[model samples]
Target: SIRLPTPISKPDRSYRVDVYDRPQLAAFMDAVKDKYDNVDQYHKLAYLRLLAFTGIRNGEARALTWSDMHLDRDEPFIDVNKTMSDNTGHGVVINPPKTKAGSRKVMIDAETANILKRWRAIQGQALMRRGLPSNVVWTNQRLSGRISSNQPREWLLAAIRGTDVPQINVHGLRHTY
Candidate 1:
């Protein structure tokens, strides 16, 4: 029997992303939550957390609806059946997940579930006041896919501004999960 040294785990050369350590993650998230919440941007925090905690894609998070969340269950999950597409020639559109395998359950931790639950109530009220249907989680259907693709990265920068927490894009945050 031959014994070998433990192998390194980092991705060698693929399109790998750097991950945030626990404290860095917490600090960045705290800053994002504080800045957004101060301006009443509840959905942004929820969206960010879902990406970080569940690895859900931006399009999928944008396309989420109250109907797609099962937050009351013993094990809460998001039903990722649809995604938002912004690059379509016609305009932003909702379509099926990128692949058959994309349509699956994404279980979430309690903290994320609570954030979503509170956001749902807030979103419902907001949509009602605006005379829009409370359908999507992140935004109304018309603006779902229209949000600038760079918004998440911008949010990350804003949160990390004046802080030592290293900057990372939202997609990379998903990889951290």
Candidate 2:
């Protein structure tokens, strides 16, 4: 049998973005208001807020579905079912989470619950306008062939382009929460 030496741990100097202030956060979302319609705005905001609130990875958020949402129960939660990767724009597909612990339910607060409700309502209307079905929570309908996992980065960049923001990346928003 062959034995391998233990790997050394490197210092985690990577930027932890979960440090945004309320005003900055508000400004960031407000700036993107025009880039999306009511449904798209709600969807982006809901997903971003979920990332911020739950510390879930972008892949996890992208793979969420209406079936995973437990909105009726008092302790409303999102079941972390799967994660996704860029599959060359075919469509978003489900994959396992990074670890066993990553595949769990995350309970959301009332504020997030309200936002999810609003997004659900707007999403239905948006689907109706596009003549698509309402079963899928996230879709590429708005971005031609782009997946939902990539929208936050693009949308956030567009949001803060002309603003006085310090160029914090969208992934940073997850850490800030």
Candidate 3:
């Protein structure tokens, strides 16, 4: 016969947090801008700027649609009510914030809003060309209408490569805000 073990409580955790300072951030943004202008990857520039300005989580940003943003209004703000999560890595699902605190409005700077507007124009033209209408803010002209969570990490790597910027995950953009 074997003895059975009792349930145990979860242990505390320590995470290594890395964030970028001013110069590093500028370099990364410049790199992303170059990609956006040279290769026309508009989403790369828009994504990093939004995360850095808003301090919102990855899921929150991914779940956002044009309806959630009031960019043209006098006071631009994002209504962060839902988030996208895919723990299984097979698919993504939209979910409401588990806590009341998770759902709130985040104000964005004018330049950030302008960046979004420019991205919208570019995306809008492509969507019109394809005769498909999608409100997803991070699609990058994809028919899928939404971007995978890993996409941002790929952008980060590309932006930091051969640059003075330190290696950091997409979450670091939020921390830098």
Candidate 4:
């Protein structure tokens, strides 16, 4: 093989983080609440609000079970000790946090705690209607299964479709928090 010179290193380019501001976030929340009032819609709204108010990663949030959340405690918090990882051919699996520090408890404000409470009540009723057990915090409204990982992002996209708010990925909401 012919000798080749070393490749030149590219300069680092900093990109701005895209996130919803106060007014935009308020508008987005209002839009979601006003447009979707059903139990299933409430679940989706709660999920979005949680991500917006907490900086936890998407996988961390997805991996959360009802056991991982302590909403009734004086200081409500969700333990972020694991993440939902795609195991390729084996399908999705729950795994420990990537780092020791990744496994932490994220506390929520009273408002958020109330939102979660409402969501749980609504979810419980829906599950009872379908004769399904309430195990996961985020479950498919029409079926007996966890909500798909892409569902939250899809909901966010649809909520901001015609609004003046800038479009952003679900992760951006974490940054906004």
In candidate 3, list every pair of residues with a backbone clash: none
Best by lDDT: 3
- Looking at model 3, residue 113 earns an lDDT score of 97
TM-score for predicted model 2 compared with the true structure:
0.72
Candidate 4 weakest ten by summed lDDT:
11-20
**lDDT at position 89, candidate 3:** 70
Candidate 2 vs 4: which has more TM-score: 4
Consecutive 10-residue window with the lowest summed lDDT within model 1: 140-149
Quote the lDDT for 93 in model 1: 81
After superposition, the stretches of candidate 4 with alpha carbons farther than 4 Å from their true spots are: 1-17
**Any runs in candidate 1 off by more than 4 Å, and if so which?**
1-17, 140-146
lDDT of each: 0.77, 0.70, 0.83, 0.82
> On residues 87-171, what C-alpha lDDT tens digit does candidate 1 reach at each position?
7577778899878999999999999999888988877776677677556566634533335556767777776777767767677
Candidate 4 matches the true fold with a TM-score of: 0.85
- Between candidates 1 and 4, the one scoring higher on TM-score is 4
lDDT tens string, model 4, 1-177?
Answer: 999999999854333238878987898788777756566588878888899998888888888888888999999999898898667798779899988999999999888888989988888887788788767787775657667778888998787777666777888889888
Model 3, which residues run further than 4 Å from truth?
1-17, 87-90
Query: What's the lDDT for candidate 1?
Result: 0.77
Can you write out model 2's per-residue Cα lDDT over 1-177, one digit (the tens) per residue? 999999999966453344578787776656655454365466776766677667777787777778888876798898887887877766556788878887898888887788777877887777777777645566665623325666788766666677765456656777766
